[model samples]
Target: MSRTIPRTALLAALSLVTAAGATATVFGTSAGAATAGCKVEYQITNQWNNGFGANVIVTNTGDPVASWNVEWSYANGQQVTQGWNAAITQSGAAVSAKSLSYNGSLATGGSTSFGFNGSHDGTNAVPATFKLNGVTCNGATDPTTPPTTPPTTPPTTPPPTGGRADNPYAGAKVYVNPEWSAKAAAEPGGTRVSNQPTGVWLDRTAAIAGVNGGMGLRAHLDAALAQKGSGELVVQLVIYNLPGRDCSALASNGELGPTDIDKYKTQYIDPIAAILADPKYAGLRIVNTVELDSLPNLVTNVSGRPTATPNCDVMKANGNYVKGVGYALNKLGSIANVYNYLDAGHHGWLGWDDNFGASAEILKQAATAEGSTVANVQGFIVNTANFSALKEDHFSIDDSVGGTSVRQSKWVDWNRYTDELSYAQAMRTKLASLGFDSHIGMLIDTSRNGWGGAARPTAAGPLTTVDTYVNGGRYDRRIHLGNWCNQAGAGLGERPQAAPAAGIDAYVWMKPPGESDGASKEIPNNEGKGFDRMCDPTYTGNVRNGNSMSGALPNSPLAGQWFSAQFQELMKNAYPAL
Candidate 1:
């Protein structure tokens, strides 16, 4: 939605390890202002045939800095491939990792970590030295201590029976829905990513049983048992049938009316919670993505906000959204094997000053409502079914073009954070401050947000104008930040993985890549879905999208239905291209 008011910038404060290409750039390495001293710890976490993952933690031992960068050289012919939490670039044996907008500050003795996946032919030795802001650190790999070999596959302690693991996704295989897999494989080149794990959306009461002969919750969990095969497996269930769901967008409105809180609790959540609590499925780690786009609507779309909507005002007044989400969390979270992750709107929807803190407080209110507490929530998920980029390499909120801040750019529109990773991590910190568990993890739905086709920018845009600086270099190619339909030039992002960053639990494909966001034009259907102009490419604009073109793909099918054209486009533009 359009957030027109010019507000003060709020910088991010957390760490997230993300993927990036290997290119050489010199920004905050040798050119950076000097720091007193530092210490670096580099360790190989996992290894494979020809590739491995490394975690680097840097401690600033000197004066405090608003931002910092670390530099090092590889002894072997190692190549840095993908990284997160920091903007990394590599050339020959030398590499530089610069802090992002969130994790830049190092308050003398403060430490932050980022990780990357790299490749090596035979030897993958640790870097002997590291420099922070141009000053050499005390050590890289400790000289006194010998480096221990790491295991090839990530180790796993099988999830304890009838208990929650620190991270359910860790050392676990995510369940793949055969139904979606078959649909994807039926496409021309969909077989490439067809087997990827995506959430099984239970959007209505009929879906809880079986919608039109489709697999129900029990069937999926039973299939997960087959997939378990002695190892842990995560079954992702999207608990999405909230009353007046997605009030800000008509495309994904629910079957229940605004006041049907009781129907949502009994017919929808109770049945699903019963099935999950069954001992037969207790071995499987059940992850419920509870209520997508539900709570944030109460904060951003309610009365008195710039982007207020009548539908949202009604939902807020009735308090059903909060009551429904709270009841769902309490019921589902009570099961030891089930982990409930509430949906936190993406950065584009809630990264502004007015929306950010207020949204977190609203979440706290919901968590405590209906006899639920913060402990019921395992974590929070962000960027679900939206096209916010995971990270923006070219421009930061702190960057200025001709003395004009990038936050002032048309696309950024005074938003504090640039991308989803920073927003999720910062949001986690904010949630913990509001009495939620400090260790609660964050999940970023990476499906269809890659923006990594030929149009993907390689380096920083020219400094001629703030707009050019952000628009040219941004990985998200949508015309406006609020465009959330089947967007043009969108791509599949990083495949699902666990513990990829500091506070993140995983990068999940919770939103199946093949399903349409909404129909491009009005089409009647038995499903409760309604056509929203944001999905129509021909629609010129809305206040939510800065009154700009919708930037949607044409000829799209109804939401949750297969749009083969959009599926093919996602695969064609997928990052880490197939």
Candidate 2:
């Protein structure tokens, strides 16, 4: 689930939904002969007792520039606390934001955006005027057009309150992303599950607005509203993009450095919180699946473990993962309708007796860091963006062959649990013991774990040896439990359903079925993703998989990017086949 891109955090289509209604001050020069002009849209997205959130979009209406800057003054005595997508600074009543390395350029007709959180003394008003590159912006129309009226006032939605439901998805219809749906429906026989709800991954700060013309947070929330129509609807969002994310994996390496925790907070999480906190989205249930493969790596891939790596060791020592997750939980959980679910690694990774208890404790540690508590977490999700089977109907974890325990089998590999369901149930129990709420629930990512096909075993294996017995019956057909990539035999798992099992809130397709795990070979891109040998079909193996050949599909694309081949494979091998 790690895909890195140094994309600008542009706040597009966000002015329409704010707490106290938006005040758009479209600015351009009045001079008819102007050759260099700009239009700035200043909006107060969220306002509170003593603080507020603002988004500014700067459009270049004149000549192009290598870089640009926007300056404005606040009528009220406001102090900027944090900002993103630009370098913001305040001196007295004047505040200025300069372009950053990635988002500086502004061509004619091009636009970019930035947002910030500020503290005010009650009266917060939008600035009357703005300046771009030291030129004052005065008129509503550009040089070519006659003067015109500004856009109408934004919708007047009442500020949301802290009245969260006990279970956000209990009686709600989950939102199906039209973007993902269209992609699925175009594929052959994809209409069967094309409408299934998948997590909207806000992988970078740019995603808070929109990335590559895709739907931004506000647009998705607005879409969710249209889909609501009266009955409750749950919008699942994956809040990824921690500094040094997925340290154990190369393919998913993130853009933020190990110490860029501040950037993660301000640039990534803050704007998302601002958008979700908007009153227009109050009625919709927002479920945030917190950072995946992060906390677990702090447990299974740090120094002292045989599978440990230097990058993981750096993350463990730096403690940014703990700080970042805690901060995100604190901010997003504060929103009444937002349910925060931390990502717990799958059974194959953490089911070992030594790893299970330790992983949960570390999560508890992260949950309590940076002013966050266990209360911030509504639940936990497992097997996200992975191919672990939801259930093994044939053999049991307690089963043995010729007096040999399944735990001794090569596939089981001394793990305490054999499948996701059993491991999730056990993890929930373990979490409860560590001061998590007794009512806390679990979610298993059945997205790619179905393993249904003609190759699937219909019955138990021969009682010859432990390895033979477990391998013959196990639904997950990977060479090793740790061989996570574009797995060749993986299939679509269960469709999203609320309360599918006891102590489980839902079985979800958190990772959409069609997306790739990683590229099979190195491909260059601006997105920070790297080529991991684990995704290469010819890769022999690593310590994590006990030197087994990588069971990955050939010619895969970058992680998170759609791969048509993988999508077809998933639908073809789907359990309850399409």
Candidate 3:
């Protein structure tokens, strides 16, 4: 065999020797083939979390490889909280990271994987540069940088603070009584009419029987909840009853005498306490006893006569009847949410000073007698009737009837209806001057405002008017507006026509949708005498008398339907996305 050795075999042997020598020079190993198999590559993937996690792909770039070690660094404020799948060690900001228990050797040109968690910020974060077995990896990218934080701005003028403002009427809520007579009749054990000298009739039983056992009460509550919606609206429930009782000092007809007062306490007031105590209606706040007392001692009309004797002196001397109401209010306060206000006639009816200051004094005395805190007394409610004329009433500015004359009058001018915007602003300014801007708020009856086809005022108009007068340096921001008497005819249909401005907090149904404003006898059909006649697409008659076309009976489904529709419309127009 030595004498005849093949040339091909000799060449193969020589080639093997040269490859071995080259491997020895590169790896310093006699096992050159084995050393050449150690080449590797690294890759990072899936970095995420509050910090970051990554899967590292390692491949044998030259030959088959066993285990490997990787290294990288992190910037300041960026610390790795936790990591997985790979062994990791951190020394300050630097990481001596490596794959742990990486099973099986990687084949040449084949890839293996590992993972880790890291921290980063928009500022100094950099993708970790990776290496395998003390050697840098090919095709390995650096860690990604994080995003930067934006800057914040401060407000120029701070919000008004301290009990809201000087205006106590601002943002005040108002509720209207729908069934005055019915509620009076429902007093428990019936109300007694001493008939003074004549033996007292057992009127208590019948009166108590008349109380609808919470039906009407619940309806009113429901009506309030429906309009108020959680805490969005400041809710006021005015309990108006005809023939309301008076402490011996202010008895009218024979009704609500001393005996009747006792019975009313046990029946009407007591039941109210029970209902309020129930958790189902815990949100009912502001229960005001709106007494239409036998007209103030000065007035003498068919409905104004005192059936008994004039007790103006007694009323003046001791505010007894007022106290009685306070007493009842105290009881209701124990079980229910309430804020009582004595009814103060409208500006047109009651001299401004008398209605505002004098009435406040009377309420103060009554509240004192009842042991109620000054806050409990609250303030007064100013209301207008159907017979009230725009020229005579300041609230007439909200009327919608069209005409050149209607546009000019200072009180009820159509253009001036736009003036309510100014009025609200002026009132806020006035309240602030009085130091009541923070505590008081005003409530406007918009029920009749939309009467005679007036469109509901846009929020921008009112806000602009208010801002022009108040925050614009011309007026104060204390006077807030509460839109009451919201009926279907109140331009709810044109709700989306304009954006609602601020200052007007709530639009409540002060006059429930269905109640009638008495028969049409007082007003003619042309004046929109009948209830449900105002907004009817077909009703083309002129407003007769001055009857509101919006007042309908409370129990009617049509009224409820209209109310539901108007509410939806108001929400759409006033608070679309909120």
TM-score of each: 0.73, 0.73, 0.36
User: Could you tell me the C-alpha RMSD of candidate 2 in Å?
Assistant: 13.8
> How many clashing residue pairs, candidate 2?
1
Clashing residue pair totals per candidate (backbone < 3 A): 5, 1, 54
Per-residue lDDT, model 2, residue 545, is: 93
lDDT of 3 by residue, 1-578 (tens): 02322434433333343210111101111133434332221211222223433333344555565665656565545565444434678888767656445334556555444433455563333322445565543231212211111011112122133222222222332322323211211222111100000000112223323322322445445433433332322334444322233222111122343334555556556665565566756654543434533223223111233322344444434444565566655665454344444443333333333233444445445445565544443333333211121122222333322332333332221222232333443333443344332433333333233322223222222223422322222110111111122323332111111112233322223433223333322233322122434333233323221232333212222211223343332233221111
Residue-level lDDT tens digits of model 1 in 1-578: 11222111100100111111111111122225454777665645445566766656566777888998888998778998766557899989999999877568878767676666678896665555578877865322112211221101245635444467878888887876766765665456664675688999998999988776567888778666754556678899899988888998888987988989999988988998899999998889899999999789888887788889999999889999889988999999899888999999999999999999999999999999999999899899999999899989888989998989988999899999999999999999999999998778999999988988899999988778998888888989998999999999899998888888889999999999879999988889877799999998989897899899999999999999988898989988989687
Which should have the higher lDDT, number 1 or number 2? 2
Q: Sort by TM-score, best first.
A: 1, 2, 3
Q: Which regions in candidate 1 have their CA more than 4 angstroms from the true location?
A: 1-153, 157-162
Quick one: best TM-score, which candidate?
Answer: 1
Query: In terms of TM-score, how similar is model 2 to the real structure?
Result: 0.73
| Shift in Å, residue 406, candidate 2 | 0.8
**Can you write out model 2's per-residue Cα lDDT over 37-149, one digit (the tens) per residue?**
88876655445567766666687888898898898887779998766667899999999999877568888877776766678886675666789987777754211111111
Minimal lDDT window, size 10, model 2: 142-151
What would you estimate as the lDDT of candidate 1?
0.80
